[model samples]
Target chain A: MLNPIEWSSGPDGEIPFGTPFPFSVPFALASPESPGLYLEGVRRIKERGGRLVSLWGSWTSGADPAVLAAFSDAEGLLLYRFRLSADDRSFPSIAFLFPLANRLERAVRDLYGWDPAGLSDQRPWLDHGLWDGPPMVPQDASFQRSPEGADSPQEEYPFVRVEGEGVHEIPVGPIHAGIIEPGHFRFQVVGEKLLRMEERFGFAHKGVRTLFRNRSVSDAARLAGRVSGDSAVAFQTAFSDAVEVATGSPPPRRALWIRSILLERERIANHLGDLGALGNDAGFGFGSVQFGRLKEEFLRTNARIFGHRYLMDTVVPGGVAGDLGRQELALLREECARTKSDVLELKTIYDEHGGLQDRFSGTGWLDPMLAGRWGLGGVAGRASGQMYDLRHSHPVPPYDQVHVPVSISRLGDVSARVQVRFQEVRHSLSFLDSVLEALPEGPFFIQPEETFSPFEGVGWVEGWRGEVLCWVRLGSGGTVLDAHCHDPSWLLWPALEQTVPGNLVADFPLINKSFNLSYSGHDL
Target chain B: MHKILLKIFRTGTLTEPLPEPGPPVKPCPLVRGSLAVRHVDAGSCNACELELHAFTQAFYAPESIGIRFVASPRHADVLLVTGPVTLAMKDALRAAHEAMPDPRYVIALGDCACNGGIFRGSYAVSGGVPEVIPVDGQIPGCPPEPKRILAYLEQLVSAENKD
Candidate 1:
């Protein structure tokens, strides 16, 4: 008897009419009517100690501010788009308030030639030190990287120098020994302890955000889903939320529930795999093989039930692309039940193992104050006693029906993160069971009636890693203006730099595996 | 001897699970003449590497299909890449593909390997494996379910058999 429409309603679901949500500043604040308003909004967010979650700009050449503001407030996140014209004098900078804004500001400056003042770190983000041309300006009617040229490492890279005594430098890869992602971690180490660490990232800067310009909204959602593999459901949901706000497409209740189910599944799957990897790093072979076995079996059943192991192409804009029958739902419930028992047993082994517990406990402590400054989200923040889970903070879809307790630990170590993930998996499994039991009967999708207009909106989903914030602008005839996906790694990666200090070089993998921040999620 | 006993005890049987026949086996069209594989890690923690290792592990034993992972590009027939290609790996990706002998195929494995999945827009990624090399087969998932990987390898080997 639960209508999907009624089910979707909540404080998070409802847009405040009198005053815009504090998280979401109106687009008019960025318009010519209020030149300094954008800066003021940043100041307000900074005053409240809110870290810059994401900063994205697109060419909204002829878009209306009112329409853009409407879309922004609808999604319950700060949304702003500024028009770029020949006569425009200056664009406001947010780095003054948010230290994390330094990289994003540099990216905007490098990509679209947007002037970002007061930025401390100005090395190129997306350009890969290739182009001398205007950043992000459409040349030849398209915004692709300019023709390739040989750029030297010393000349191309301009890392902020940090000098001190007995600070021997150890630079580990753009290309590493193992087949992991290419990133150069320059560490200033005095023996085993890391004095300082600087990350030289953006090595695989694909022109994804630029590519979105002029592509249809529907097509762009598919691209958004692929932005991050493990968090595909979360990314797609954020994009879908933005699109739904822009085009006024509220998906059917069943669709929303299905989307939530896929997201939780994605979370559980990634957590399971990482749990095994972390155990492997600790020399606990028994736990590794056992957890890995569970993960494999979990994925096999996922493929059988959802038709894709990682559940690709399952979530589209407005509603889910795939349908789940009653039998399949029952099968999924069975799979979750089976996996839960094995995972619980594995947890007992992990807990009883004093070797792992000794290594994982109090290894990496990310203080709550530091977490707040960096705006860390998801498990990393939760492990460090920053109690913020999106499902609880801002319930979306099926989460509204099922209450999720925010798990936290003050220890802020490798074990803390492991425990957080364990608890979350159990929470997700229980929620999935509840959702299947309460599955509503109705149409899964709601087709958009309006012929697509170039509108701007924001989509925010609490991915397994953390909150994934996506800023999307639709171009003429519903084509993409610019779509920027800011993965949780944006914040978590910086947190990794801060937390790795005082820990032995050997313990880096354990600490890193504990966090498991996605390199691909942050790269694009 | 210990492993054999452990395997038997684990399964309660002497043999591994086998697929019922009828799955298609096609050799990689791009590698009609020979097979050489170049690996590029865009950005992954190493889950995909385990699966790749599993292909060589005694448990899976993929060499019977004549699917060997190559280290050098000159001797490689297929480019089997993993992780979400980060910004730093771009040059290496191009260089690896350029070094490979002609008629090479690219097989993207894992979620990040296919479309830079979880790592899509990270500061370091160049995108999926295909963007780095000309991919013929895409094996998706967070380190694809080993069976899917085995199936893909069988197809690549069978395609080579046809040639």
Candidate 2:
């Protein structure tokens, strides 16, 4: 049973325990009062096993430093920020309490140069050999600019140096030979048994956060849709949710149902594709081809039913940018029916394939304790007995009406991840049928009544990968202050290092593909 | 009979390679027969690979239009790329692309593949495909849907066909 949240000045400026879930605070602590009270509050929450969802902060000109200082009291949490304001101003680092705050603080420090006190680590994250001058100082703001050629210091990033005998390095690509994205991996291995693997991301960091500063909300939503292309519906939904929360506007009922349907389809498409890839990795060509063909068929049907195969830009704030007609719905239902039968048949074949099971079963194991520590979510965390699903945790919209049973496994291995995905596909397929059958009718969008000016909006959606959180802030005249979208990959990537520990280097692909955390999603 | 059907299904019969277009562009032995390629996003939002994925799922199926996506890039002549190349994947993508051997072609999947899309200026981004290595063809889209992606791939093949 979940504990009730107490009423107080909750973190993120929310009225403590905003919606009476349950802890009644004995007393209140003001910003001017002892900051230790806030620290104590976090400790109490942690002791009660309340996992950190996310931390949000802003630097308004009139914002009090006292309120900011109070944030340092919370222990053991991570702040997922996409950008920082130019001023060397930011809330105190929560890293003292949350070890995950290490990278986030470094990220904030890199962008805004406000070094939070008491951080365990303070190395630059995204600015690897890239920027010169004061990073991310808002466009019209002024600050002490770095001297000429000051950017040169970024070349030799002080990455953690690896040492020890029998630990030879295997340097892999900033330039890979594949059709995928670019990232460099320096693996320190002892004859294929890996010792340590260091990753250098941001090679593809396209400045998504800073680019949002001047864009309109509509355009920003479109940009958000592209933040990680495969999860377009999920990103847009999260973006829309944040906008809705800020503006206090609810998307129309029809729009909500349509969004849910699109989200389900997206989830199914990815699961099918990943299933095929997993089979391929295990050398089960039969499973790979079968799943691949099914995925192809499903995607083709989607393109026929929806305008795009991946359902891009179909979801927008206020409501979905588009809708599905009856004929399309009927055809989709027919396709779903076919897919269900085909997948059931294929599953039998996969089960009987002993060769495939060997590589998949115990390949990469991530324990539940580690998952909780890293705040892992989505399929990655679900497979490890961490029963946190956004659809249930924060019941929003159409999902609130339906009981979405999340599938979980405590195995935390490659097979466990695959099994969870399979279970989710079955659930998603059933949910799709129900959604289509009881499709609601209403306006696709409702004109929002509340106007937002220079306010921050936090939007979250349970994406196919897991929880996709987006933060949108607007400045005076409705210009974007900052737009940050945090992908579950942020937590999952670190877990990969732990999972691959006992596994062979050759088995990395199968393990990695099973988890398949997003490079673009996390990089942004 | 069922087992036979399963066997045949698993084999995925290779379509007879399209005869080398009469007198390939100039004296190029490198521009070999038809190729089918399959592109996987792994975890993209569908902005980049969606375009390529769209190419196959849409009415055209890239192959029907002369540019195909095989289940493996090993069978592919052109490897289309996209997304702000991720951190964990720089090697995987390269290994897959390099596994194609000689006379291979590389296409930047989208703006993200071209210059990391909206993420072009991000910390976790590695810029475009070229930043990692040389890219032959470039297609720009926040994600260009299948029709557009097919058009681009077709143009590349036809251009190669002519040359």
Query: Which digits, one per residue and each the tens of the lDDT, describe model 1 over residues A1-524?
Result: 21111221222212211122222222222332344655665565556554456765555445321212111122234434443334442355666666666666666666665555445455666556554454345543343332221121335465555577777888876755444556778878888987777888766565566656667777887777666666777888888777765565567888988988888888888888788788888887656556656666666576787777667667777688877897888888888898888778677777877888998887877777888666666899988888667677667667766887887876778899999999988988888888988888898888743434455456667788888877666644666666778788877877888888898888887888888877666766
Root-mean-square deviation of every model:
7.3, 6.4
Alpha-carbon runs more than 4 Å astray in model 2: A1-38, A55-91, A142-152, A156-165, A450-452, A475-479, B1-30, B34-46, B50-108, B111-142, B145-163
Winner by DockQ: 2
Interface-residue RMSD per candidate? 5.8, 6.3
TM-score for the first chain of model 1? 0.87
So what's the TM-score on candidate 1? 0.79
Candidate 1, DockQ score (0 to 1)? 0.25
lDDT of 2 at B150: 53
**For model 1, what is the C-alpha lDDT against the true structure?**
0.65
